[model samples]
Target chain A: MKLYELIIIGAGPAGLTAGIYAARKKMDFIIITEDIGGMTKYSWDIENYLGYQFITGPELVEKFREHINEFNVEIREGQKVIEVLKDEENFKISTKTDTYFTKTIIIATGRRPKELNVKGEKEFRNKGITYCATCDAPLFRDKIVGVIGGGNSGLDAVLQLSRIAKKIYLIEIKDHLTGDFFVINKIKKIDKVEIFTNTKVVEIYGDKFVQGIKIIKNNEIIELKVDGLFVEIGSIPNSEIIDFVEKNQYNEIIVDCKNRTSHKGVFAAGDVTNVFAKQIIVACGEGAKAAISSFEYLKYL
Target chain B: MEKKVIVYSTKTCPYCKLAKEFLKNNNIEFIDYDVGEDREKLEEMIKKSGQMGVPTIDIDGEIIVGFDKERLKQVLGI
Candidate 1:
């Protein structure tokens, strides 16, 4: 088996940027990912990413893909990494179909959408419940939909659904919206959106499809009839493939200033790591740093 | 007879793009529908899949929701 100098385990903002840096350094590396854009593709309006004043999630990811494509980088898409094992000096990454050996590894797998875990959620999945508004909003055209969460993701879903759905019920457990001020202000102007703060979805009920949701607000139980439900509460880190690394309570890999994990020759970046900010630009910078750090570590080997 | 494949998707959906690219790369022929613009196709997609999600692929008569590459490979016998 040919051992690679490095293997980047994702193709999101972090993994893509790491690939660009690794290619510039002329490192023998390849990226293994289930998808190209990761969570960035689910975003609606991204005004914070540097260089572009405004860009959608998929648009920004397209630019990233283009940039990485400029280099002769190898990206194995549609391959999900099932396990990562360290054997003596090299790390072995096992996907569903094949296994790869690398001298160093960069984990930038990012995160996945957090589930509501309430009743009837699992039963109604894909029936009337969805996680990606960008992919499923058009199906709820002219119908009533409920959005759970007041964070950026939830607000983004509402913004997209406002143009499609007839009525939107924005439910949040907190007393106020927790997303960016700009998004909150934008959502406030939409009269069709009914904001319910300090509310909890107790149960979801329906027949084959979702018919309504039971929510508790101010010590009172309220039933809402909706055609679709979008869960955008938050996300959990995708850091379970490797169990040797230390993780916080949220399962986010712990990285130092240089994006180095507790285990040597293994680095992590982006939302998967314990980074203060989970911004796209932040992930990109961390990815570059992880690449450089891995390159430096490889010098002694 | 060749298997008929239909993909219901939107232009802005990344998963939809990925599914189309997968089909193209595998030398599979499929008809793409932009449900975001075509309301009739959108309704058709919902009625067929019993759900509202992009990249809903119809292979022959089986409806596979989302970009299940494994399922696609198995159903298509690729």
Candidate 2:
């Protein structure tokens, strides 16, 4: 098996930034990712990332991939890393297709979408229930849709659906909508959007296509009929592959100021780490720190 | 003789683009069908492919789902 000086586990902003820095340092490394952009690709627009006033998430990632394509660092796509074994001196990373060894490892695997866990949620996935609004929004035009949760993602989905779908049901378990105030104000004005605060999606009922959602509020059950259900409850860190690694209460891997973990040759960055904000800019900043730290670590060995 | 390759896909699917790119890069001639908008063709594709996902390639009657690069390489003798 071929060994690398470093192996980055993800290919999002964090992983891409790390690859750019590593390549600049002339380090021999490889980035393994199932998808080049990760969950961030679902974002419709990002005005926060530096150097650009406004950019789409997918477009930004395309530029990031282009930046890396200029480098010597290898980029292996469609590789889902399933396991990581940290030995005394080196680490062995195993994917569904191949195994790789690396002197140092960067755990920028990031997070996965939190499941709704309601009945028929899994059975009706892609049938009508989708997590990615940007990806599946076009399929929902002129249709009736319901969005679960009250966070930024849910609010964003509601806003997106208001323009396309004929009707939208914004169901939130909390008493108030918990997204940005500006977004909430905009979504509240749309006549097609009917807000159902303090409502919980108890069950997802569907067959070949989503039929409706069963929501409970104040001991009363209300079933809202819709063709599509967008679940944006929350996110879960993608640390299942490295369960052996120590993590905090939120399942976020604890890292120092430099993104180093409790393990010697292992580092982590982005949403998976215990960072205050889960923005693209923060992820890129953390990634740069992790790469520089890794470079410094390699010098001692 | 060059084997006939047909791809059943949708406009919105990213996987379909990848499969098409993979085939194009290998200089393979293939027929394209958008199953999303074409309901009749979608049913026909599901009946043949036994799957609902896009980027289903029908290589001379053999159906393959997604972009299985290794399998495609094997069948194409690339």
Candidate 3:
């Protein structure tokens, strides 16, 4: 088997940035990812990603793709890394179809959406429950929908749905919406949007498709008739493939200032790690740092 | 006869792009509908699939929702 100098196991902001850095350093590396953009592609709008005043998620990811295309970086898309094993002095990555050997690995697998786990969620999945508003919001045009989550993700979904859905029920389990103040202000002015804090989804009920959702607010169970339910309840790190790395309470990989995981020759970056901030810009910086750290580690070997 | 593949998608959807790219890369010929603009196709997709989601792929009369790569490979025999 041909051993690579480095293998980046994602193509999000962090993984792509790491690829760019690795290529510039003239390192023998390849990026293996299930998808290119990761969670960034699901973003409705991004205003703080530096250089660009305002851009949509897909648009920003296109630029990332274009930037990486400039480099001779090899990206194996549609292949998800299922396992990572440390083999003596090298690391072995196993995907569904292929296996790869690398001297060092940079994990930037990012995160996946967290499910509400309420009843009928699984049965109604893809029926009326969707996690991607960027992909499915247009399907609910002129229909009624409910968005769960109060963070930036939920707010983003609500913002996207506002322009399409006839009425939106913004349900948040917390006492107040925790998204950016600007978004909250904008949402308040949308007459079709109804904000419900201290609310919890008790169950999702439907027939062939989603018909309504039962939510509890102020000890009262309210059944909301809706055509669709957009789940924006945040996400959990995609850090389960490798078990050797140390993780925090939230299961996010713990990384040092150098983006090094507990396991040597294995580094982590982006939303999968316990970084202070989960921003695109921050992930890109961490990815670069991880790539540099891996290069330095490879020098010692 | 080759399998009939139709992709109901929107331009801004990443998964839609992925689905289309996957088919194109595999040398599979498929028809793509921009349901976001084509109201008639959008309604046709919704009526056929009974759901509203982009990248709803129809492969030889089998409706596969979303970009499930493994499922796609299984259905397409790729």
Best by DockQ: 1
- For model 3 chain A, where is the 10-residue window of minimal lDDT? A132-141
Kindly list the per-residue Cα lDDT of model 3 for residues A1-301, writing each as its tens digit: 9999999999999999999999999999999998889989878668998899998887798899999999989999989999999999899999999999999999999999999999999999888899988888887878899999989888989988898889999999999999999999999999999999999999999998899999999999999999899998989999999999999999999999999999999999999999998999999999999999999998987
Q: Residue A110 error for model 2, in Å?
A: 1.1
Using TM-score as the measure, what is the rank order of every candidate, best first? 3, 1, 2
Model 1 TM-score (2 dp): 0.83
lDDT of 1 by residue, A1-301 (tens): 9899999999999999999999999999999999989989878679998889998887788799999999999999989999999978889999999999999999999999999999999999988899888778877878899999999889989999999899999999999999999999999999999999999999999987899999999899999999899999999999999999999999999999988999999999999999999999999999999999999999987
CA lDDT scores, all candidates in order: 0.93, 0.84, 0.92
lDDT of 2 by residue, B11-78 (tens): 65565766897899889999998775566776677678654556679898888877788899988889
Chain A TM-scores of all predicted models: 0.89, 0.93, 0.90
Q: How many residue pairs clash in each candidate?
A: 0, 0, 0
DockQ of each: 0.41, 0.16, 0.40
Candidate structures ordered by lDDT, highest first? 1, 3, 2
* lDDT at position B41, candidate 2: 76
Q: Residues A235-289, candidate 2: write the lDDT tens digits.
A: 9888877866689988999999989998888999999999889999999999999
Better candidate by DockQ, 1 or 3: 1
